[model samples]
Target: MLRQSFTEQGKRVLKIEQQALIELEQFIDQHFDHACQLMFNCVGRIIVIGMGKSGHIGNKIAATLASTGSPAFFVHPGEASHGDLGMITRDDVVMCISNSGETNEVLSIIPVLKRIGAKMISLTGNPDSTMAKLADVHVCIKVSKEACPLGLAPTASTTATLVMGDAMAVALLEARGFTADDFALSHPGGSLGKRLLLCLRDVMHSDDATPIIDQTQSIKDALIEMSAKGLGMTAVVNQQRQLVGLFTDGDLRRILEQRVDIHSTPISQVMTRSCTTADADMLAAEALNIMEVKRINGLIIVDKHNTPIGALNMQDLLKAGVL
Candidate 1:
C-alpha cells in the first residue's frame, strides 16, 4: 500500500495540475487566435459540444461566453447525434471539446455539423487527432500529466481545458468591449447585477416618505421629521423647497453636547450646509461608495434643480441588497 499521507497526496495532485497548466500555456498559439476570431465573427450563438467530463467543462465555457457577451450554449455530442444537431445553424460557430481529440460520440456528429455549414473550433489535447483535423481551427490543450496518481482520471487535462476556455472567453469579452453593465444585464439575479443595475431612484425613499423640513424650522421640528421618516436625517430646504442643508442624528448629538435649545434654534443654524449629496439618477452602488468615502450612513438624492427628491441611509441600501 502507498505510505504517503493524505495531505502529501493532495499536494502531489495539485503540483501535477499546476505543472500541466504551465505546459498548457505553450499551446495558445495562432490556432487559438484563429479560434477566437472565428467565434467572434460568428453571426449566431457559439455552440460548445463535448462528451462525458469534457461536456461538463464545455457547459461552463458556454455559460461564461454567454454572460460575457459572446452568446453561447452547450449541446452534448451524444445528444447532438440524437436530433439535437438541429440547434446548430450555418451562421453559428461550434466548439468541440475532446481530450484525445478522438471522442467517438463527438466524432460521430462532425460530418453532420460540417454539412450544416457552421464553422468549428476544436479544443483537444491531441492536435493531430481526427477531431482536430476535421475542425476549422484546432486549439491544443495538451497537458504534461494527469493529477490522478494512476494517470487514468481526467483531472489535469480537464483543468487545462477549463482554464483555456476561460482564457478564450475573457479574450473574446475584451474584444467585444463587454462592460460590467452588459454582464450585469445577463445576470440580473446575481449580486453583481443588483450592484450595477440598482439606481438611487430605485432604492431611495421618495415622495411623502422623504424626510424634509424647512430651513426656518426649529431643530425640534427637524428631529420630528427624522423620527417620522426613520432615515436618521432630514433635508433642510428653503421656501422654494430647494435643498439648502441637512440635519442628522450626528448634529443632534453635537447640539446636545453644546446644551443648545432645540426648540429655539433654527435647523439651518445647526445643519450641515456643505454635505455629500447624490443625483437621483446615480447608481446605488455609486451612492454607497460616496457614503463610505464620506463616512456617512445616510444620503440625500437631489434632481438637476437641486431640489431634494429622495433620501436614504445604509439601512435602505441593505434592504435593497445594494450593501
Candidate 2:
C-alpha cells in the first residue's frame, strides 16, 4: 500500500508538470522571437542574472547558450548590487529571471543595469510585476499550478522555466547556423568531439607497428606477423610494398575449414583482393561507418599511391575513445 501511494504521488507530479509545459507552448510568440533577435545582435556576451532557484536555472541556460554559439555567462543578482554590476556594459544584453517578477535582489539591479545602457530581457511568471514591466522585453513563464501537493515548493514553475530556456537557446542556435564541428570545439574532451575531430592518422598504427607481409609469404608467416602486430590481420603487399590483398582471422578460419596447408600455402592464394580501406586523413568516425557497413573488424590505412602506411582495428578506435 505504501509503495502504491508513492508511485501515485510521483505520477501526479509529472502529470502537473507536463500540463504546465503544454501551456508554456502558447507563450512562444512574437515576444520570444524579439528576445532571440536581441540576443543574436548583442555585441558583447549575454549576462544572465537571477536569485535562488531561478539563479540555478539561469546558470544552466547560460551554459547552454555559450556552448551553442551564443556567448553567455551567469551572474548572481546579490553580487551585482555590491560591485559586479560593473561587468555589464552598453554593448551587453542582460537577461533576468524571477518567478514572481519581483525578487528584491534581482529587481534592485535593474536601474543600475539600465544606467549602464544594457538591454534587458525579463523571464517571469507575472508580466505586471515591476521587473517585467521595466525590462525592454518580457517572456512569460507562468504555470497554472505547482506540482507540489501543498502548492508551496516550486516544481511545475521551475520545469516550465527550464523548458522555455531550452526553447530560447535552440532557437538562437538554429538562427546562428551552429554546426556539429562548431559544437565540438567547445566540447573537445567529450566523445562527440573525438568522433568529429580525430582522424585515422591520429589513432592508426603506423611504421613498424603495421602488420605487412609479402604476398608470396606462406600462411604460417602471415599468422606470425598478425600475432606480432596484435591486430588480428595482416596486409599483403607486392615486392614494391604496394598493398595487393588482406589476410584476416576470418580468412584463416575459412582456409582451415577447407583443410589447406598453412605452412606451404601462399597468402596470395587465400587473401581477400578487394578489402575495404581508408585514407590516413579520413575521420575516425567515417572509418567506423565503413567498418560497420562492410561488416569488417579491421581496416588498413593507405597512402595516396595505394601503399600500405598504417593499420587499425576496432580496438584502436575504442582505446582512443573515438568508438
**Cα-lDDT of candidate 1:** 0.93
Highest TM-score among the candidates is held by which one? Answer: 2
Per-residue alpha-carbon lDDT of model 1 for 1-323, expressed as tens digits? 25568778889989998999899889888998999999989999999999999999999999999999999999988778878999999999999999999999999999998899999999999989999999999999998789887888899999999999999999999999999899889989978899999999999999999999999999999989999999999999999989999999999999999999999999989999998889988998999998999899999989988999999999989998888
Score every model by TM-score. Answer: 0.96, 0.97
lDDT of 2 at 255: 98
Index of the highest-lDDT prediction:
2
> lDDT by residue for model 2 over 140-183, one digit each (tens)?
99999999978888889988988998999999999999998899
Instruction: Count backbone overlaps in model 2.
Output: 0
How far off is model 1, as Cα RMSD?
A: 1.8
Estimate candidate 2's RMSD in Å.
Answer: 1.1
